[model samples]
Target chain A: MKRPFQNLVYLYILAGLSLTIFLVHCGLKALTVTVPAQAQVDERVTFVMHSGAEPRIEEPGTYTTQLLAGIMVPKSWNAREQAVLTYTSPKGNGTLRMIPDSEIEPVSGVSWHQAAKNMFGIGPNLVDDFEWIIYRSTQSYTFSNNEDIDFNVQVACNVGSENMLVRLGFYVGSSIENLRPEDDQYKKFTFSDVFEVSGGEGDVQDFVNPQLGTIQPVRSLDNDIITLVFNGGVMNTVLDGLNEVYLRAQAFDSDGQLIAEVMEQNDKTKMGSIGGRQFRIDIWPRGFFAIEKGKQIARLEYFFTNADGTKTVGYGNTEEPFRYTFRCE
Target chain B: MKIKQLLLFAFVAFGYLFHASCEDEMANVVTDEPVKNITGSWKVVQLTRNGEDLSQRLNLTDFRIDFKEDGSYILANELPFVLVGSGAYTLNDPQYPFSVLMTADGESEQIAVKLQYPVVNGKRQLSLSFSLGCAGNTYQYNFEREN
Candidate 1:
């Protein structure tokens, strides 16, 4: 027993010393991300991810490198084309460009953009509609063995036409090793507090918190097969703990009329059990609804129901259905 | 003697004609035609509904279409298939297929869909795109040759 006690005591001391050494050699000093508290649709906003990072290169020789930056934004923003990144530092400054999708990064044998996504996934966001938009400084910097530099990047991006609360995530790293943190908080990832894009149209999509159900491939056409999911176990609802669930969905035309739509509960509209009391239905919107010529599904309002068409549950366990609007950016 | 000479001449002429006819017969050249053989049972390994993957979320392992060597198909599904029940199928172009035409039962109208025969992971994949209900929605069903 005494030998075990001595071993534990040695372990505690070793852990403390290791942490101290890692902190002393920390490359990232600080990271601060600033996004507009509120902005308008179609408005171009300046989002900032500021970081003070010194080179972690020990036994450094003169080497060339570029700073890697990534931002997780709503897919609706179409940031790949509409956003521009630029940097500022005591070393130098220049325009930053997006690393094209699937461009191989030599170190990881994967695309640099994909490597970042693999490293930091969605960054505490609840929905999968967000994408990691990454960029690299077009200008490479040469630092000598004795030199050190710190910098930050600013992004000018266009907000989408949807009014929603978006939780934006920002990340910073280097091309040296596209992997983990040698030290805790290597300015690796951080998220901005609820950035708002107001004065737009449609429902407010909350990205900061967990949603009961969200559609994948948020932008879709009537000719697409849309899968609707319900997490009855996520929160308390009228339809909770029910083994059998059905979907009652109404498809509206562009004129908002219930054309080519059916709001019914039947075996065809029955939700399949995905375990955990979660339910899903994969249906082609065109085939599911009886639409005439020139008629199409513009949006959908849906609810989860128990057998006999009773105990229906809607958004937030309320009476109103969860709605989704379909469009491409 | 004249009658004998005439008979001999007729016999010689007949013999010469038979020889010439034999020489006129050319050998029938037989060349095998190239066949694009995707004949086998194919399983739906991946089903994408409007660009959304439903492979993991749904149990689509049982879904399949068997293309027999006799140019007939048995659809083992009620899936939003364009053609229903057993059908006689044909490729629009044998060498370079652009579409797959399916004639169900005795239906006069044939159902056709764009087809892409691509080799993925060294396995032949049959990819078909069609709209069963409304023409707007497109579902891409990728089926792989079953072992």
Candidate 2:
């Protein structure tokens, strides 16, 4: 009878051992098998220029493999945790978002602050209201090799009144300063990060003429007249024909697609003509032409020659080239 | 005999539970669901200057617009030129109409819209306009709802 009891105990011990092994294997398999749930990333790329002394430019930076592609955050992550990365380009600055183990989708039409919180952080004040647009990548690329990629991101934000008036200046340590025509340092820099914007034309003339000082558009058509009217008081030297002037036009479709380009010259000989030769102008399609109907036009950039013979460019008001569609028969 | 069997079953169940809980602790990364409102390809159908149709072509994508509902908006082009603008905006109620009041590139100028017509399914046909320097223009636009 005692021997039978011992046999029973032995059988129980064996069964328990086998069960432990089986369960351990199952747990290990579960841990090894990674199943990424349904995930989506919406990437919006904005080319931004820093105003003030720094005149900083921001562009999209490199990403790590550990950083997931989409902007969605997992439900398990704390609202404060964020994977924030910043990249600086010659033209501007770029910010990339990394969300760890999250399942929450980013909110639409909200400010950048709200979006950043949802993507990787539960923490407040992590996002700057000055920056908007959350962007994502489509084709997956391996970050293992540290490859630099320029992901084409797009989205339309209001071209506020401030930027509406074309800013005429140069970048100084990643910041923009109100350019003075006579300033020698101002003549060295050029325009960059040309993008399409959706906003009311701010101060088209607010952009100072590189040749003449304090410029404004006089009786102009963004679609028809590409004029850069310079006031007499700003810098009378260009009007006196003492200096040469050059105008460069870069055009893009409404969706921010580059369309046509023209660079024309209006030197000292041509300066004294228009009282001020206000339209240090550049014309496309020769004589006169209208945009083909049903076609969408975007950006228009202008660059001018400074007194020292160097150049300074200004961008025109960016608008949708889509023709008016409201006509009652 | 019955007690013994019960004990054996209990032991097995406890082992399974312990293992399963441990698995949850690993770096289980997963993909998130697609966003609802701002997803998919969006075509630029309207361009306005102070509310007037400047009559130009401006076709671009959400990628082109530099708009990600999650962050600030930046619009820039290829080279030799770039401008940075930023501001806040929200989709106003009468949710069906889908109105948005936005300040562009940090400018004080305000833009407001009220959809009037339909462009695509789940999208609203709207009239949008902006104000600056006592001079403002209005235009009609077609915006689709995100699928």
Candidate 3:
């Protein structure tokens, strides 16, 4: 009788151990995106995304879902047309297409493009005009119960016409699950090392490092409103630790003649602090300068100054003012 | 004779009620709402691009749009706008306008602009949203009645 009772207890212990193994670890276990440290403009750069995930069957049933990937690049790249994505896993292998701006993310309730933007905005980059081009798998995989899967994706995109250093970003998020799954563990993201694209257009735009001044809509007419950002914390400077800062700028006409200038550190020219050491000001050239009807503004030469105008910061942290050209293609 | 008189009375009452209802239907109009009043100079109180606010960075205080009582508008210190200088303007459904149609001084074609009129902080506000150079970049300008 003792032998039989001992056997029954042993059987119960074995069953518990099997259930524990079946449960396993659930969700995105690990992920990494690999890309070359440097590439030339208009050159095709390959980015390899290797990811592992284990699905936990909360209930007894089969489910169908597709994977999705979001890749961030400069808006000038026209990535929607230039980038191509392909994936291979135990589930299947197929090419991915740019999920139209209309395709909605199941969990986020927003377009995949927008969802990616909301998830990571530039990812520590200083430049403002960046786009997250989202791609969706062409095939769906079926799964039931505890299962382990691995995916390897190949992404190729041509660099845009710009000489710059920027960190690329990648995000793998919420699959097209036909059933319930953990929302948090399904998302993983990473930013690559400073990517250098040389022999491109214009001057070298540094996004990895902070700067004294930056402007948006790199190309715009005088008729459009423009934003100028003064980064005081870029490095040691006169206005580095000051709590208050102001902008003193001169607007020039097409012929390089100074048309209007505002050097007052009053309420109108005071810069609004955007947390940290960054400040911003928006100016409509037509209104700010009050230019005549037929004349057009050529550019703006400006500098940052502290209250009472004792300390000033200019181009290359020198006494020379920073110059920004106003043009539109 | 009494029975005949009672039948005549019933018929007369029914005819009188029917005629009264017809008259009511013909005179049922009671228009109450007046045309939306937007005759004032406005300036850009807020500006946005692709839904990102840039009010602090752009100097929009001098930009002005004057909507005169003569159904004409004049633009001063203009930004990217559909019609420039002065133009003849008209409202769609004057009583409850959802848009304003403007024909520039030289052009005959009409450009319809979506208008949002709201009163906040006890002051009337005019909001206009448009895409000037690229359809991808949208600019919204909100203007409050300039004191």
Best by lDDT: 3
The true-versus-predicted C-alpha distance at residue A200 of model 2, in Å, is 32
What is the interface root-mean-square deviation of candidate 3? 3.4
* Tens digits of lDDT, candidate 2, A252-321: 6656665655544434212222444443332322121234534534444445544443444332222211
Q: CA lDDT of B131 in candidate 3?
A: 69
Winner on lDDT between 2 and 3 is 3
* Residues A233-304 of candidate 1: C-alpha lDDT, one tens digit per residue: 678887877788888888887889876655677878888888887888877676678555467788888888
> How would the docking of model 3 be graded?
incorrect
In model 2, the fraction of reference contacts reproduced equals 0.00
Which residues of candidate 2, in runs, are more than 4 Å off? Answer: A1-329, B1-41, B49-63, B66-87, B94-98, B103-117, B120-127, B131-147
| Cα shift from native, residue A188, model 2 (Å) | 61
- Weakest lDDT window of 10 consecutive positions for candidate 2 chain A: A26-35
Clashes of 1: 3
Task: Kindly list the interface RMSD, in angstroms, of each predicted candidate in the order they appear.
Answer: 5.3, 10.7, 3.4
In candidate 3 the C-alpha lDDT for residue A102 amounts to 79
Local accuracy of candidate 3 as per-residue lDDT tens digits, A67-145:
7778888877888887999988887789888888777767668787877787677888977667887787877777776
**C-alpha lDDT of all candidate models, in order:** 0.75, 0.33, 0.79
Ten residues in sequence with the least summed lDDT for candidate 2 chain B: B75-84
Per-candidate TM-scores read: 0.68, 0.22, 0.73
